[model samples]
Target: MVNGFMGRVLRAVGMAVRAVHVGGIMAGYALLFGAAEARRLLGPRRAGHGARAGGLHDGDRWVKMLTRLGPSYIKIGQLVSTRRDLLPPAVTGPLSRLTDAAPPPSRRRVRQAVLAAYAGTRWPFREFTWEPVACGSIATVHEAVTLDGRRVAVKVRRPGIQWVMERDFALTLAMMRALGAVPKLRKMPFKVMHEQVGSAILRQLDFPAEAAALAELRTNLAGLGNVRIPEPLADLCTPEVVVMEYIIGLRRFAPGDLDAGTRRQVVQAVLAAVYEMLFIDGVVHCDLHPGNLYFDERAGLVMLDAGFVIRLPDEVRRSFADFFIHMAMGDGWTCAQIVIESAAHVADDCDVAGFRAGLTELVQEASGAKSGQFALAPFAGRLFDLQRRFGLFPAPEFAFPLLSLLVIEGMIKDFDSAVDFQAEAVPVLRRRNMLRDRTAQLHK
Candidate 1:
């Protein structure tokens, strides 16, 4: 009993320390950004230029602070980087460059995790590199050759990552609760948002689940001839370690390096695969950041990392498909109605007519815009801002599907600026009978 009490007390002390550290960094940056903004507004012309430089400096400092805070904050930065609507370009631009790379844990730690994962079984690797080829917030991956001479990537979870993440999540929730006490913030579904994000982060620790997701995605996306998913070696996978095919490709590729034909093919395959996942399969991979995707001339679009996958219910899938189809067709009224229907919460004082009008305008503006003309980042930002304005809190099911698309938009635009992102989804929408039903419903 005494030991249990002591453990609780220690955990409390640790969280308190963590809170102060996190709060200090955030507060310091906030003040720095505020001062820069003030200078930009009220100072002389030279001071305005200095303020602009200061903003850029603050953005870099923000990235550094998040990295120093460890995995949870790094992941949070990546997520916030997607919200171009919530923050200015100065902040989001620097954040978009925040990769998940971290210094590898000790070799002893990696070996211990590997041994524990393979307990009671023969060590299967013929050759294994002690140095990690890639290290990220959750795991470090080493190149290995199996006993049968097959090359693979051995991904081992960081030591005590679960405990560390849990502690950070607790502190984050406590902070959110404190924020929730403010009347203006109380309307936002902070608890639900935290639960959704927290659960997804925790889920990444389950290597077995990730392995299964990879297998399922491989099977589901096999029909997309040019898209590839790394096949997880099921026999070798465990909660702590996952061995998969070692894909050889470049995560950063110059578009000009690829022939136009290859680039178009690659872009088409990626869009088709993503649309299939969102509309047809209802099984979506939420993390498609640059690090998790690769391009190979031979292998085509190589998608990696299935650690953050979400399966939408059939109803939600259909609703979202309907929403997208209407949005494409410029049926803004229907889009607005779908938004209301699919929202997780409708505020008691929600401006229903105002929301519908605002969303209608947003959709109408987006309709028929090609990738070059239509930027999903800013559009999503506007959409989210509108939702917040009208007190229509988005369901996680709805939000994640949108995030899956948002994460890939930049890559797609980079690959083929002329591609009509909305129009490209028509064939898939038709395949799912969504387009036909929508037409009939509208005509009736």
Candidate 2:
């Protein structure tokens, strides 16, 4: 093993090589695809030559490119997909299809991690299947049976993942620093957002924190009869591995498979749980993608992966909830003020009136002609664009939860559910405000 400055130098060099390799792959695809599109546009308009014939989408080539680069690249693609505010639907839509699940570690590595956690080769679990049920960048989860005959899922962090993740993030930060010098990119909140996201991903490498988050979320959501969080086996959990009650279910929602009543129950349950997290709990499971959320007709929704939870300060929570409430009510000026207050950086000469006027027009336009027609994702996307013009930058506290809400709203809409996000979330906001007011009066 390497140590001291020598190790740092080696790691930096390795990251540079990886970056060049990945960057080359990305640029190659861009050039090839750009040429194809140019040919199609400028050349003869052949009857058979269209987007479908060229590929599933123009972004399809990128999916293949990123996938070929390996797990870290795939994870990056998945992360970028959540940025609906940054990328257009055409770009992110294809990226969302990039799967996080990968091939499991070798049986020897899996058994060794479990043994290391248990402090010996002898394991407590009666049946520890070498085959993993799911595999991702940070960890792999396998199905196992405890000695007491309890069905549990054992999640083991991949060996050397910490080192890889550290190097990758270091490289990411360096790239961001390089990009900071660019005139156009300098205005974006890349540095702050990257710091927050990088920290969250690093925290996820620690399984004990994940177990704690899962338990706390279960306790917080206990009253919601429809939501389910798997019980973590505390005695068996370690920083390297976590054993929890196994939940076997299908991925994402399939409306045709379930009865109308069941579908409504499922949709309502998910929305209510999300609303409560945003407004009441003040902490949320920041990664709300479909893969982490499972559905069972009888068990309701099974939420997995607590590694990326975000805790909001009370003031931030209240301001965020109120912002949405005002947005729902079509009070864009108030929302603008709330955003300005939450901004990490605001220009002295920023035009508050111009922002308010533009945002009001956007809100009214997105408010829809009637109920059930408005969308929160598009509205939030416009706000992201507004930040560029107004010199108001997002703090991590605000950006993370806002992105979480946007992702959840997109999931709800994907199922063609007519649930009104503002209408549903308004009650949560009102209730939270009422409780706050009551507590304040009591304190006085």
Candidate 3:
């Protein structure tokens, strides 16, 4: 039919437009890389522990470009900001400020997603706010009230987000392939990083998972009287929408806004809660940065954004706990041993002795640092790099907790410089070990 022929023509035209749009963004990134190469050739060289001579200028530009490119790229930029191993401080430091808040979806789209999520099931919301309370890369959250008068937060996915994400990921992988061809970049785990992060972003698209994670966290963290997680309304949640009981906060706390005592309490509460998540519960809220964490004056530190959760197997969790405990205690040999045992693949040609030496030296350097001066992010990043050099590829589960640690370390440092991380974590580590021992004995 003539109509079918016209439809085919329209489809082709639409494909062409999308290709051009994506191609234009790719071209922008290419130009940025070209500038980086030019800087390497012509600019003054800088050197230091984490010195990146040419990358400093590119970081802000990358941020701008990612922002303009839309949600998927913005999400990647936020993730890459935390990846100190893949990028230098000059780049990651600036990119760390990249906010996840994006423009909100139209009210019409919100209504459609909400109706679909609650289709044929006694509509839960008595009143749904038209304007969004929060708009992030994955979804926009609106304030709503249940039929029974419970205040809730309804997170609605942006229309066509998944399709856009898929398109952008394909483009990103293609670009990675092109970049990986360069000899200097060949050894870097671009594919692993891409696959890991891309998969995480995709997984986050599942709102049901987020809802489940929130419920699991609430149950697991019940003992932590001060810490809070938003309560999920299980029956109302769907893949595109998560409806959770909302907690009212007087305000999100800034580090300097609180007194020293309050700050110390907040930091300790966070450390204890997060330690439980990693060592005991075996599930972690992978994104625990400042923006995702809030202080409810009455309810303690409130953790948000449960989309990027990671679950570790029992063995992996035990090894991770042992590794951190040893690292905190300055036992680099034990830490290195744990890492070797935990790695996914160790090359035949790996120099075991050399790895041990490097690890020992690295740990010594870090543990010897003065209080408030030690940086765990860079330390963990260097450890990752060392593992790569030894041809040891760690499991994705192993890397995520380290990234969480990096985020937590930064948050704690901002709150209380005087708080001794090792001393504070030691008690929790001991408690975890004690529980493990008790469990082992019970099984025997």
Candidate 4:
């Protein structure tokens, strides 16, 4: 098992390291080449046409480059696309394929993990099957029952998963820092996001942490009759193993698969959870991909995998709240001020005035849309452009908020064509900001 862990870890880490160094540099050159090609093709005679073609060309190259950069960077590419709060979707919009249906682990290895976690201990149940009903990168679930026939779900950690995750995460940070400067991970007030995201990876390795998080969430929403979080069995909780009360129902009934009424309920439920995470709880379940949420016909809603939680410090929360409201109220100066506050350790080479101007344009363009729609894809492009030009960066503190928004945007788009993100977000944001504003001296 140790050898298996080390071997897998080395393989993933080696690949990630190579991807960022070799793949990133090669892709950078390719981008430079493409820019030259487009410029020469259109010349000064048609700069607008050239820029348009170049934009498309850049998009294509980034996807190809990320593919070559290996799995780790590819995952980051997907996160980049979804971060509408930090990025306009335009840049990441084209990179959406990263998180789409990853390959599942083999059944044989999964069984081995189940046996390892249980250590051959016999269950009181007449039959406890070991087959994966659901799957993801590092884990899968098996349905089982107690001796008295109480239905439950056994979540088994994939063998060697921790090794691979840690290796990849370490390599990613190394490469990112090699490319740019960053402070420590979450332990540091001024850390890089590459470092911050790694904390979630580390925390997720310990299943006990996940069990505890679920317990706390249940406590938080215990009285909210409609919301239900599974209870983790205390006797069954271990670092590598977990047993939880099961909702014996199919998970992930996609938006189009249900009747309009059911679909609307599902959409609203998802929206409400997202709103509460951002505005009320401040602790977010950062990964709300379809599979992480369940619609129990009888129980209303159930959320899973609280291990990957993100809680922002109060100061950063205020900054985000202020930024959000400023955007909603069309207060560009306030918005820019809040955005600036949200970043730390910006590049010395960056032009403060130019960066501010770029942000001004972004907020203006986004706010100008006929109904204040969240034009994510285009906005992502502007965000990337801003990042490149001004090095506008994510403080370790805002990591959860940004990630939460990304997940929410994707969920919103799944249901409505006219899902105006700005409009949906504004009201809740106003309330949060008002709270912060009151506590912070009332705009003195």
Best by TM-score: 2
lDDT of 2 by residue, 285-335 (tens): 977775578776564788888878888888888888888777777787888
Q: Write the per-residue lDDT of candidate 4 for residues 95-129, one digit (tens) a residue.
A: 65444433445778776666666675664444566
User: What is the model-wide C-alpha lDDT for candidate 3?
Assistant: 0.77
* TM-score for predicted model 4 compared with the true structure: 0.71
Worst 10 residues of 4 by lDDT: 182-191
lDDT value, residue 14 of candidate 1: 82
Local lDDT at 342 for model 1:
82
lDDT (10s digit) by residue, model 3, range 1-444: 999999888766755666688679779778877877676655544432444446335777676677667777777677666555446667776676664456677889878877877787788788989798877778888898988999999888888888777766766776788887998666555677778767877888888889999989989998989878899998778778888888886355457668888888888898888888888888899887545788786838788879889888889899988887887778899888998888766777777888988998888887777766677777877888898787766776788777777766755776787767666678788889899889999999
Q: What is the lDDT of residue 347 in candidate 3?
A: 72
Rank the candidate models, highest lDDT first. Answer: 1, 3, 2, 4
Give RMSD to native, each candidate. Answer: 4.2, 3.3, 5.8, 8.0
List TM-scores for all candidates, in order: 0.87, 0.88, 0.83, 0.71
Give per-residue CA lDDT, model 1, range 1-444, as digits (tens): 999999999999988887788788878877877887677566556564544455434567677778777788877677666555446767776776664466678999898888888889999999999899877778888999999999999989999888778888898788788888998988888888888877888888888999999999999888877777888999988889989999875455336677778778777777888999999888899888766777765747888888889988988898999998998988989988988988888999999899999988999899956555877778788888998998898887788888898877766766777777887898998988965577789999
- Residue 335, model 1: Cα distance from true site in angstroms: 1.3
Q: What is the lDDT of residue 43 in candidate 1?
A: 59
After superposition, candidate 4 runs with Cα above 4 Å error = 1-108, 119-126, 181-191, 221-225, 257-265, 430-444
Runs of candidate 2 exceeding 4 Å displacement:
1-3, 35-52, 55-63, 70-72, 79-100, 120-122, 184-189, 249-252, 297-299
Error of 3 at 443 (Å): 1.4
lDDT of each: 0.82, 0.76, 0.77, 0.64
